[model samples]
Target: MGLNAPLVSPRPSDGYDHRFTEVDYLRGMERLVHAVQELSLARSLSDIQRIVRTSARELIGCDGTTFVLRDDGICYYADEDAIAPLWKGGRFPMTTCISGWVMLNRAAVVIPDIYADARIPHAAYRPTFVHSLVMVPIRTLEPVGAIGAYWAQERAATSREVSLLQALADSTSIAMENVRIYAELEQRVRDRTADLERANEEIHQMSLTDDLTGLTNRRGFYLLGESALRAARRNNHHCLLAYIDVDGLKRVNDELGHDAGDSLIADVSEVLRTMLRESDILARIGGDEFCVLVTEPGGDTARLKDRLAEAFRTFNTTQARPYRLSASVGLALTHPESSHTLDELLTLADELMYADKKAATESRAGGVNTG
Candidate 1:
């Protein structure tokens, strides 16, 4: 298409005339600004690419156009047409080629006649029948990409046309920068949401864990106990709670160091966890107190107690340590008809635990070893 064909604006004063009226220049500037706004508001990268190609084709009045961008240290042409394949999928070092030259120099280059300009290497324009071309770097101070338009017929580009393309290139730069900033902001928002979710999960875990033994703490125990009670009350089934108190833990802490005391607590917690069912809840409430909430009331309660005793036996026999890990356990059963509240049931279990501890102490004083 002819440059002054009026396709873009009113025909430029007929013929090889390079001069432009002041009104024509202002109208072209206004059109360039409108095109830039349209491109900037594009929703996706694909949409932006389409708009860029169409804009270049219309603004520069070329038969074919090529749009290219640099990403990950590699240059890629965004066009799919096969007529002008400068380096289709072939790598061009950013130091060479008209597009690369414009990118590196960060300025617009206009060639009135491609064959006459010494800078226009002959081999570059040989593939396409293009004789005259104009290249404008689509960027601000730092070049991000370039847009090139080619003509099949040999014709000289006017100063007004070159200036108009430069303005359009500048608009392209702003649109590209705006899109980049928007994408970065979206990515940052996603990253922040993921970080918040991770932090919330960690906080939840900490709230349910005991600081000393790494087991479920008192708050965890009550929460689990309440849920179990509600389930049993709903189904008219039964559940049990076993309150356990470790024997002679305070004496060990006083005689040895706090590290030894911590080791003892951790070992006991591990034993309890290993002996219980995966569905059961094991929590450390006080310095040497723990609670296990079993789902079923009758047979499972007895089985869980046996498992706990076996775990302690195995630990005492395997370890060469002088101090023994032992506990007094008290059981409390809850049924649908039971009148006791959750707290009341726990109080009854605590009283039974004290009775067991008293009986164990009496036996120890009588020089009778339960083990």
Candidate 2:
């Protein structure tokens, strides 16, 4: 008979001693149990894979060992050495290989002698020089991945060796679960933090905007205007503040209802937002009143007035309502040598606005109506 053929052991004089001696078997089992306990404490996947590689190499006395994980239907050798390159991220159809078959069935496969087994398909063993193989499905609540060990020469795997491998596979399953749970929890935390930041930003924006016309309210205007004035002063730059008042809003509201008046205000706000440069600030400071801060060189009042007039004309053409959109604009320029507070500047601008309103009304009624 060939050396590769199955051997029949001689019968011992003592029946119990014929098999493995009790003391030797117990010592081996104790060592395996300790090894499993050590593997269970591994926190990360890399740690678990390393433990698996080292433990398998020692326990099975194989030339090399590999650990693979199943992603979709494909097996990737998450950790392996060159001696068993086929085990590392190597692709094999489920119908063709021992590892794939074990994964599909969710059971352990022991090939005592790969060459002698008829159930073992020929094509599966063609990629590597593996002759003796033991594959165990690393089963969790759901099947995760698989672990396998192989010998270069054909041989029978001892029962104790198979038991140790199964224990190691179980340890790997638990470690994989821990790592997956940690990763998912970390992702959830990041998603929640991002969602909260978005909500806070929206709330902050709502607090700064006027409810009536979707423009910056009085409080927001003062806060922003003061900041802009300070910045311009520090940089030795010029800024223009234009205070505007709707000429006949009270009459329009009394005759056409507050809803129509509100619609006209919204239309004006949209026009001003569109006509001004993105750097300029447009704000609603009071009923039928708004303010704009324009930062530009030369401080051209005529250009600013023309832009306002164009915006008014656009609103008149686009709006379907009967009431016309008209505003009296009052502009003030900041000077470095002047000792004018923001409140004082605002008062001057307000006085100028009333003067413009008076002139506009007088001009409209041919110097008769000067309210």
Candidate 3:
């Protein structure tokens, strides 16, 4: 906690303090450069999650790491890269989750003695290997997510560790924001091109677009998406199916009015359009919900996910709307080698989407620990 402590290396899991020399700084900076490069090209939330956890684990030297997303009054464990499995897909109430604590407070938190910390739910901690931890919100102003680093023994996260983790968080925020911007620009160009092709105007007008946003409607999605999947199977191509739910739609409707909510839907559609190819199928399956079927040449499951995250990130930045737009996306991919049916893919995608949505919702809560 000293002024110079942050400049020192993090405490190792062996309960020994490590000294950071000039060489370590150079190595750390080098590692960070690689992290940024990978993150910049990462087009999916999982990619971002993986990169964050791996980089933090290496730089902070923690025994375990996790990436959490807030959804619907809960903190959902979206991904993890740890010495032992902690909460990969479990849901925790905001008050009980340290990651949630960071998001709600919009600040970083370090608990050297998690058992002694009243903020931590002791019962939950009793089963985990984590005796100490550090958590940082992905963004400071209006944070959308958080990252957690855990230690197997009682140890303090040095100032240097906290600063390093925060830096990574800031970098992640920028990567997410850029994804949003790219998707927006890409959508605008597509819209303009479609406008120029006047020959198809009448057919498109009568087509299956949602009345509010121009995305394909539920019927259109099922019809078109199923066909696309069938084609992928025939051609032996891989496919990615994603279910997306817009975050805070109810809040936007309540705080900003119905018209604003409608705008949010339209803007999010633009994001979806940008993330996929002209060949891919996208549909507005429900109010504040979208489904994307992607399995085209030069596209894989990982690439589709990366682009999806970019769309959400880009929308949050470029759209000058009163409310910030974000989404919880669950993606399920069908391998060219697997004989998975469209119905099977649908069930998986829907279940994953709800799981992610639940996490985002719980992370936004303000009440007592809902353990």
Candidates' C-alpha lDDT:
0.72, 0.72, 0.77
Q: What is the lDDT of residue 12 in candidate 1?
A: 48
Q: How do the predictions measure up, each by TM-score?
A: 0.73, 0.78, 0.48
Candidate number of the best lDDT: 3
Estimate the lDDT of model 1. 0.72
lDDT of 2 by residue, 1-371 (tens): 21122334343443221132334345545655666776667667888888787777666566557787777787666775436555565766665667677788887777757877775766756788787777777873456777788777765555555666777788778777877787788889999999999999888878888998888988888889888777777777787888888767788789999888888788778878888888888899888788998766456766787778776766676667677777887888876555566777788888887877766643451111123
TM-score winner between candidates 1 and 3: 1
* Per-residue C-alpha lDDT of model 1 across residues 196-314, encoded as one tens digit per residue: 99999989989999998888899988888788788877878777888888877788889987788888888889888887888788899999899987766563556656667777888
RMSD of 3: 27.9
Candidate number with the higher TM-score (1 or 2): 2
Runs off by more than 4 Å, candidate 2: 1-55, 82-84, 112-129, 140-142, 335-344, 362-371
Against the true structure, candidate 3 reaches a TM-score of 0.48
Candidate 1 regions exceeding 4 Å error are: 1-27, 38-51, 79-91, 110-132, 140-142, 151-156, 178-204, 228-238, 296-298, 335-341, 361-371
